[model samples]
Target chain A: MGCERYRKYVGAFADGELEVKENLEFLEHVKMCPACAARVDEVATMKGVLQRVYAKVEPSESLRQRVAESLGDASADYRHRPRSGWSVQLRRLVVPVAMAAALIFAVVIWPSVDRFRPRPGSVTVVTGRIVSDVRAQHTACLGRSGGTHQAADLPLDVVGISNVLSRELKLRVLAPDLRSLGFRLVGADRCGVRGHSGAHVLYQALKKDAYLSIFTVGRLPEVVTTSNAQIFDVFVSDGGPLAVLGWHSDKASYLVCGDLPKSELLGLADQIRFADADTQDPTEPVFVRRDGD
Target chain B: MGTETGQGNEDARTRFERVAMPHFDVVLRMARVLGTGEAEAEDLVQETFTRAFSAFDRFELRTYGARPWLLRILHNVFYTMRTRAKRRPTLLDDVDFDHFADELDEHASEPVSADSVDWDQFDGEIKTVVAALQPEYRTVLLLWALEGLSYKEIAEICGCALGTVMSRLYRARQLVGRALRNYASQRKLNVERFN
Candidate 1:
């Protein structure tokens, strides 16, 4: 068949959406045609890169708190039964009485207004400390290596290490696959931030001489900011030689500190997956579905 | 009756927290892509959850997951806000592949070697190109490429036919590819001029 007829199928073929017979034919044609092969390659690369760019964002803790408060109000309102005329009139007076009490309480507490208000943009102080600690640990690891060192003699493979950490920390530990991104696992170790026990997993890029250290903290403070088209609330600390990106889920918090750009670090962060906290056994290996599976 | 109502509300809240709230980041991500900016996206997400909660009684987990359902609410909220503000989104439909095919061939034949191109520069360029795409095209592209939604799920979230989702994604890729090739060519021209 002419290239024109096969052009439309190229996208579906790259997406792995073509029928079995058509997919076979499409692959056969691409092997013989460089232009068609290039088209497929371009599509595949774009898909992979874009997926990396779309890192999962951790919504700010404030939002979650707000939602919970709103839901509480909603449930309270639902609990109120319909009332007769006298009760309705009493309910109307209750609003004004409540407002009066609130006014009095506010006046009494007005002296401590300065203490109550958080400084502008300083809401993420706790998150900042966690990220800083992770960055410091990563720097320490680099200094310990002294440019190059043999991989640490760890007793566990990636899964075994995850199980051990998950059990010890009492939080699910996710070991993301980085082989496709050209990084191989080095080793794992026990680490902590602010007395919270956790695990630190190290990886080195296969091609580039770059290193990545992922620190999983059991108790992490919520800190996040929104930027540009990216949706994830990834707290990026990029002042030093290494860039640190931190985020958290309901179960555990994570920090990926490395000598990489913010975008690349965020991409690596997205690849980390945790097993369901209630269903999966901490001692069992967590399964991560690969791309194009 | 009062106890029953309270139990129902509690159940609804529990289901929402478990099913809907977990997908907040996904909804927020889609909102940022679909809305004007971060603040606007955050507002849209807030409104989406508010509306979704009010209508939570109708939500069923059997047919579709919470992500798609939440996304549908987000899209509705975004468009409704746009409509109320009298801001009609400009839909770009010029899907001419022939023009891009020649460019692709020329660009692919004499491909810029990996060593020659600065990866950071390329990454920034790709982001810029994607951000510059028309909203209609960008939404479908993001839903498919970034969110990893299948065509069927995209159709459900987008409230369109599966074929429409496929075509929009194809066109979006073509546009992005064309923009990328143009960027590379511009860089090449600049390098030659300097040399």
Candidate 2:
């Protein structure tokens, strides 16, 4: 066959779409043909580069929330219920109004309060600490002897495990269903973040040595809200070697941190179900407050 | 029974969330490619989900995952909107591929090294080149090359035959490759002239 016919198979071969017989034929042709080999390599490399570049375009969190809301009754299990039409209208107006108010504040209230001006990137103070603490716990625990446990040692079921931990820790612990995402709860430990008591749950990938740590703190001063505000006030940051995805509700704050990509960590965060601490007895005592008022 | 109905709804929602929602990023990426701008892409994605949710009952979870199905809906939504606005559908024959192929062959000997390429600039240039292609070619190429869909899957998403997918992809790659070669050669020439 001429080079043109073999050229037609180049893409299919690179994509591994060709039949076994045709794939072997294409490989044989390329061995003798440097130009065809170069072309194949170029196409394959371009495919890789394109995937890397284009896959970086993440959809905004607002868009995710908008789609979830549009699902209406279909997505009833979604944590954030859709707002009523009037509330939606109010929200639409609130953003622009708030922007206008901020503009006015900057213009009128600025000159005298230069000292109080918020520092750039300082908004993620609480989130940064949470990420750092999670990374620290992950390292410390992974380093300590007899720190990790097997699945057989603890409750294997996510909900069962969370229930046990919640009872033991006297806090509403969330055990996200990560089985579908190919992760299993390996163990749990008593860990504290910034001197505040919390639970650090460890998970191991079913087929890999990848580990993820989920740290829950009962109370932290809400420092800031990051990009995704629709579901929960959440922030995502890179913790040196690991990526951290953390979110907060009025009752508790949770962070899922791992060496995985930010997107993967975020996916795990989305699956987490924060226990409704509201339903628990009020006198049972929630997160440990800081010493002395 | 009430309990049975609740279970069914739960199952459907779970399936949709797992199968359909996971592809949100890629769908949005394709939406940006298909739509005119960010706002249009957002609208396209919204409409795609709305339609997909409505049609979720027909989505057979056991047969296939949701990426291709969602992509088909996105493509249909984009083209339908374009048609309603009286815009011309970009046809494959709109571009002269013979010349593109010739240009590509001329630069075949001067293979560009992967490391030598400025990926950021190359990414932007490729995006422009892709956006300029006919919609038919663009869809096939994006599905096959970028999204890593199989030719058969691309055929299914595109509502075409496998052979058609192969032919369009070949031509699309040639066009993109030629454009990249031209851009690289021009950059090299400018650098030489300046120095």
Candidate 3:
């Protein structure tokens, strides 16, 4: 079965609802698939762990009383209070009578609050001890680099590296391909881009450990392109320990990061460059490979 | 038989007051296991009683008995409340068990033998570890473990599909296993640290 098809069956397999034949088939597949086996194991472990973790949670005595009392109060209120119809009539007559009388004495007053305005999206900054620890680690890395490299863990700064890189490469580039992956933008900052002398820009994802950092240098020290390569070429290559993909268009260069296989990265880079050629800015500097020097 | 019925009702009320009331603390403890905290747990028990008493008319003393009935009400009320709103992810959030795979990299590769394990200690830890599950998982396991409800009754009470209840129970058991393994490792680490 395909992965999504297998995913649907995982719940059933966990329930032992599969027929003997199907169960054997599923288990056979599981034997060959370590990732799926690990997932099943984790799901099982997570369920049991959650049970024990919540085993002793007692509502506070006061909250218990409050809920009970609230229930009692609602019952009493319902019994005693007039239902909505009668109350509505009473409020209408009384309020109108009051408002009519007050209208003569009422001064025309301007309201302080704005009404019918579209509300802006609220930005929430989540600060946690974990983020603090990461920040501290970043500071330590910066110190190790003799303050020349401001090693920071913020995601947005990594994204911003694309802009710096775009400027240097004289081509339009954007960090964090939002459409391809549903990654949220995190904070960004300037850091020593790994190989370049000048500061490298960085951007990051809000949740995951994924980051995009680019070194911005003025021009590729040498114009190097293979025969098959055009203004923009996307290729996935083994980036030593990490898998890397580099894409170039006439305008700018983009590099995506992950432990992804070289073929996948290169394919993605090529596809992106082909699709987004005209939309990108030409002045943005294309990214030069660090090893090229 | 009518006389006997009246007598049975009287006895049921009296028994409920005594036997079930004393089980208040235990029931509360179980309620927590089922995902309600101290206050909500108490309300759960109160609601359990209110429903149990009101439905006392329908309950057959000869059939399934009071414990299961009371637990059924508790489980029903818990899932009802839980389903009404988005539940806050409980305390055990971000505790991914996958990280335990990294511990294999540590020294001391001695594998523990099954014979070396103490059943009593293991059982006790199992209880505690099960106690430590996130509220969502804990609730179903509690209905199974503490109340001894069958998967069918658990599904009915939890208002989930039978498979979901069974899956949850199985998963809950697996988590208990992981917790036991984690506890054993932590204890070993403590011993090593002290040494």
Q: Which pairs clash in model 1?
A: A57-A232
Give the per-residue lDDT digits (tens) of candidate 2, residues A116-193. 642221211112223345446565533332234223334555444544444343333445545544556766655554
Best by lDDT: 2
What lDDT is reached at residue A96 by model 1?
A: 88
Docking level of model 2: incorrect
Sorted on DockQ, highest at the top, how do the candidates line up?
1, 2, 3
Structural similarity to truth (TM-score) of each candidate:
0.53, 0.53, 0.32
CA lDDT of each prediction against the hidden true structure: 0.59, 0.60, 0.45
| Candidate 3 residue lDDT tens string, A113-165 | 33432212111111232434433433344434333544443335322444343
lDDT: worst 10-residue window of model 1 chain A: A120-129
- Model 2 residue A197 lDDT score: 50
- RMSD in angstroms, all models? 17.8, 21.2, 25.5
Clashing pairs in 2: none
Residues A1-293 of candidate 1 have per-residue lDDT tens digits of 56766777676665545554665576567767776766665665566567555567888888767766766775676567455899768878897899899898788876688576523212111111233354455546433323222233333455455444443433334444455345577666565544555556766555444455776553232321221222233333436435556665433456666555455555555544222122222222222222210
Model 2: residues >4 Å from true position, as ranges?
Answer: A73-293, B1-11, B60-62, B94-106, B114-118, B189-195
Ranking the candidates on lDDT from highest down gives 2, 1, 3
TM-score of chain B of 3: 0.58
- Badly placed stretches (over 4 Å) of model 3 are A1-293, B1-26, B35-37, B60-63, B80-132, B189-195
